[model samples]
Target chain A: MCEANVYLIDKEGNEKLLLESVDKLVPSDESIMLENIFSQRKTVKARIKEMALVEHRIVLEEKD
Target chain B: MCEANVYLIDKEGNEKLLLESVDKLVPSDESIMLENIFSQRKTVKARIKEMALVEHRIVLEEKD
Candidate 1:
């Protein structure tokens, strides 16, 4: 019904929790903006690596 | 309320419609499984590149 939690994966393949209950995602000029159910917003320099919506998990790899 | 349309981005960065109204995405062994609202299922060897849920768009790049 809602969006999944976004996690940032490091080069060593470690998963770092970024945001929770993300409701929407918007791609911007050089980054992506995330908005949660509470309207909490975060902009990240990362790209989606994988998404398992059924499992409520989203993996992203940070970029420069 | 629902999921977004899944698009495949080729090497040339062209967007090609893959699935519409995708409701769920499940990560499998080496591929990802997608399910639509009508229970339609499709498995693709791809990786998530970007998502603009508010815009109802999900971009994926094919993988070997």
Candidate 2:
């Protein structure tokens, strides 16, 4: 089984977006991606600062 | 780490609903529950026929 999650970050150094495990991650643009799952999907666009893993959730923090 | 997912079923023996993993499950009535998480939450009401685990996602099927 593959555990999945989504996160978003800004140009700073803070975590701005968090998402649960999703079925697919599609990049729509240079700074954005479409997250889709069984329930719903959302669009996230931001400068990626950093990426990390929190337990099972994927943590994405913005760059400053 | 808790890998979670939500499922919904109708009165018959068929799977009609599926949701991503949520932070909590709140039962609002005898046949419904409110799922809450960081992104969003939705209400699901149906007769649960069976429950099982597929990989990490929790599968809930309706009763017939």
Candidate 3:
């Protein structure tokens, strides 16, 4: 599966896993929506911080 | 292939195709790196504007 693992990164450079095996990501307004292959969905108020597509890792920065 | 098509979105909300069938994306210092399944590589000074993973569309905002 090309689905990616999502993480939340804080200003201090700490990373926290947000979701696993996420198959889809949609941006809406100021938030991002994540959907897994199983159709499980989640929404986070954050912005794209960094991405390593080949590594299936996506980092996000939470909005204040 | 699971690679995504990359686009550059301007402040006016206009979209411009940057790359096609990109298989990997990596963030560096002040740029984002793109690599295709064929190992083609490119670097752009931009930030993620939005992403539609299921649609294989990745939007980016060019840095000024």
Off by over 4 Å in 1: B1-64
TM-score of 3: 0.65
**RMSD value for candidate 1:** 5.3
- What is the C-alpha lDDT profile of model 2 across A1-64, one tens digit per residue? 2445656655564554466655443322243343435556565553223222224444433323
- Clashing residue pairs for model 3: none
Model 1 alpha-carbon miss at residue B5, Å: 4.7
Candidate 2 Cα misplacement greater than 4 A, ranges: A1-64, B47-54, B61-64
True contacts kept of 2: 0.03
The parts of candidate 3 lying over 4 Å away from their true place are: A11-13, B8-16, B23-50, B59-64
Q: Which candidate number has the best DockQ?
A: 3
Q: TM-scores of all models?
A: 0.57, 0.35, 0.65
Better of 1 and 2 by lDDT: 1
Interface RMSD of each: 4.7, 15.2, 3.3
Q: Residue B5 of model 1: what lDDT?
A: 90
Backbone clashes for every candidate come to 0, 7, 0
lDDT of 3 at A20: 90
Tens digits of per-residue lDDT for model 1, A1-64: 5577889987777889999988676654467788887799998987656666655677777777
